[model samples]
Target chain A: MSTPSKTLGDYVLGLADDALVSAQRMGWWISRAPQLEEDLALANIGLDQLGQARTLLSYAGQLEGDGRTEDDLAYLRDEREFRNVWLVERAQSDFGVTMARLLLFAAWQSELYAALASCPDPTLAGVAGKAVKEVAYHLDHAARWVVRLGDGTEESHQRMQAALDAEWPYLDELFRPVEGAVVDPASLHPLVLARIEPVVAEATLEVPQVAPARGGGRAGLHTEELGYLLAEMQHLHRSHPGATW
Target chain B: MRDWPLWEVFVRSRRGLSHVHVGSLHAPDAEMALRNARDVYTRRQEGVSLWVVPAAEIVASDPGERDAFFDPADDKVYRHPTFYNVPEGVEHL
Candidate 1:
């Protein structure tokens, strides 16, 4: 494990990476959604998450005191260099599966940001405060769908449960502490877990009874899926270096 | 497959204001209705609060009654405060 930087800069980058990758994955579904309204909804959510990623990444870059900007980090990073969890990199399987992932991710992020809002650093605090509100709405959006699908018709219920089962293993990777990570899991775990468990239980989904995947995000190791994600996301930038919008 | 019902959305930009009607969308139920409303109507940060009502539930005044219901009020000069005397110290009427 590499020695962790205690600075908020390093920690914020981790958070930003998580949002950035998830946003990219969600954005991939723009015209591919099963329905038109859903296409718009996912796109909107993707934009919101991207907005958050931009804010956090820009702040992280500034705090690092390196010459890198948000665009530099977002456009230039290699697949192995990104620190997002594997769950976010996985392809969207179906609407139900996407909702399941969104529910889990949003619930965790909302709690994480709520706690982060009280951090000693004012910039971190302010960012978290703003982000928490957005994430709360996102969680509500996902939670309501979970309940609707869980309690709906036989087909919906079955699909919802299957979605839960399929995504359950990935949940563990979210909370697994990054070795020598700047953020203290000891301090943040209770707060994040307390908020996540009840929501999962309420959805009538079984929490993962299995061991966590040997998560390697912070170590810059990633699932095979990430390479494809990076290829699609960075293709424009990599092909035409320094191309402007 | 049956399509979801259409819903009308209203959003309040902030507190102490009525939710002004924005647009309409289709959703499975009230929960999804609200979510759809938020995503479609409030993407530009134009709202701080949202209200979703089924398009079927809203009882709007008849357009044919516009003259009978609203035009009459325009002629009622007593309702206007323009004729009322205002104290000099009053900052707002």
Candidate 2:
């Protein structure tokens, strides 16, 4: 492949990191979701995110023209060195919160990937084309959960609303535009909102007017939770350098 | 969560193919059950379409009636496709 501009590389890197971090978080739900079926569902969704991470990471590495492999990009980086939004990094111990974060994140990804699917960059376009379908499923799954919990019993409705409120702050981070990206992130915000609003409405949930969190993940700045997550994710690689089955 | 009803899943591998019973999963409603079936049964390109029916709705015949219901047909060799003569130039019969 001819040399890709660093701008494109950085944009794809952000996308890769987004999928990678979200995969790590989603993996936490396996065997831990409310039901066994839900566990399998989350595991499948997590695997999808992991698959996207691998493909995008490899492409991002190529664009950077650096010798770093996907493994190097994942295992060797410090928390601040990563570029995923805080939406996927923070602790989501509550299942409702997990679904809420997923709904927001996947909605943005749905729009972002759809826009990127037809971009001039063939590699990015190819990746986005595949990812758009995967994210569509993710969005649907999340929306289902959000609707079920939010419109169910009073206790569940309260909890789901609270989850949405908690996740709202991180929503802004997703729309911060990155240079050299196929689509302007800012441009996809309204489309993402349109995808999310109907789901929220049907769930009988409100989109809270909470202030946006201070987000610098695109600049390699991350939340305190990311450090803990990175410790777990990077530990195995650091302990057994270059070892693989 | 315990209130979620169990749904029997059926998957059609492709168009023009009959849906085969796969397995069962618990879901709150038919829409969610279809999504759950997509995740549980069709994750590996296993099917193009899915059907989810509430487990309570299926009226399965009693196993105790196995002899009365199926044994009578066993001795009727004429009813079996196995008695058909082998035709040349044909396969997968």
Candidate 3:
């Protein structure tokens, strides 16, 4: 059994992992987006995610008292070591799919950060305060795209609905409490769901109905896709352990 | 759909100031134009407001008109307030 401190470290790492994985996914679209404006927007959102990851990972390292920096956690972790939900690691299917993912992810993250802003831990609260603003903007951006695509032309509406249907299954894992996981599900559960429901409804997307995916990320049970994601994300760091610009 | 036209962005950093040209971006319409302007131009929190006009709307004076248009103003000291005088009680003067 893990001590409370260690459990806290694990919980922080889980949040950091979520940000890190999402940032990597967004970074992949840097120059490959359909338009220049979207390219910049994705890049900006990726930077925000990376910034949040850095803060959360650093806090986790400090809590662990393992002398691991943010870079150590981000660059040294292997696939099985990461704790991000499967939603963030899935491949970017199409523009509408990407928007759907963002809409769902950002809504949850915005609420999570808002609650964390008042967490008992001062460091966590500080980090969450800064991150909440960034996530709010991210949520707005995604929501706008969802509304536009969902209500636009027939083709756009069809594509966006398809994307929503496809991505909905993955959202359950976001709110699922890992059995014996560090963070208490009962403590955070109500706040997370309350904040996410309205945004999901506003987007005209249905709440995920599937049973939560078993094997929570806190247990290091990740989807197979995480391996490839880690391979690409950790390559430079693993290749040159202490590399710096 | 094809991409939107480029729009030149002007921002007013504060009230009572002229809108200064910042940069340009492509937007599908006026609504999108304002949003893109807010994101790209005001991310740094530099502006209190923004104005986006299509790049094509701007007209320019010929470079050859520099002397004829601007040089005459350089010699017109009367156009400026240097000759103004005020009473001792005129606080602003």
The candidate that wins on lDDT is 2
Single out the weakest 10-residue window by summed lDDT for candidate 2 chain B: B75-84
The lDDT values for all models are: 0.79, 0.90, 0.81
lDDT of the structure predicted as candidate 3 = 0.81
lDDT of 2 at A19: 94
Fraction of native Cα-Cα interface contacts (under 8 Å, chains A and B) also present in model 1? 0.60
User: What ranking of all candidate models by DockQ puts the best one first?
Assistant: 2, 1, 3
For model 3, residues B12-52, the per-residue Cα lDDT tens digits are: 99899999999999987777788778778877777998999
Give the true-structure RMSD of model 3.
Answer: 3.3
Give the poorly placed runs of model 3, Cα more than 4 Å off: A178-215, B14-18, B54-75, B85-93
Model 2's TM-score against the true structure = 0.94
- Candidate 1 lDDT over A117-158, as tens digits, reads 887767778878888888887777777778777777889888
**Which candidate, 1 or 3, has the higher DockQ?**
1
Docking class of 2: high
Candidate 1 has which clashing residue pairs, if any?
Answer: none
Give one digit per residue, the lDDT tens place, for model 3 in A1-245: 87678778888888899999999999989878878777878878998999999998998898788899999999897878888888888888498888888987887887788777887788888888899999987888888888777777788877888887777777777766654243454565567567556656665656656654454566688877788888888899899989899
TM-score of each prediction: 0.83, 0.94, 0.86
Candidate 2: true interface contacts recovered: 0.93
Q: Candidate 1, which segments miss by more than 4 Å at Cα? A: A1-10, A34-36, A179-182, A186-190, B14-17, B59-93
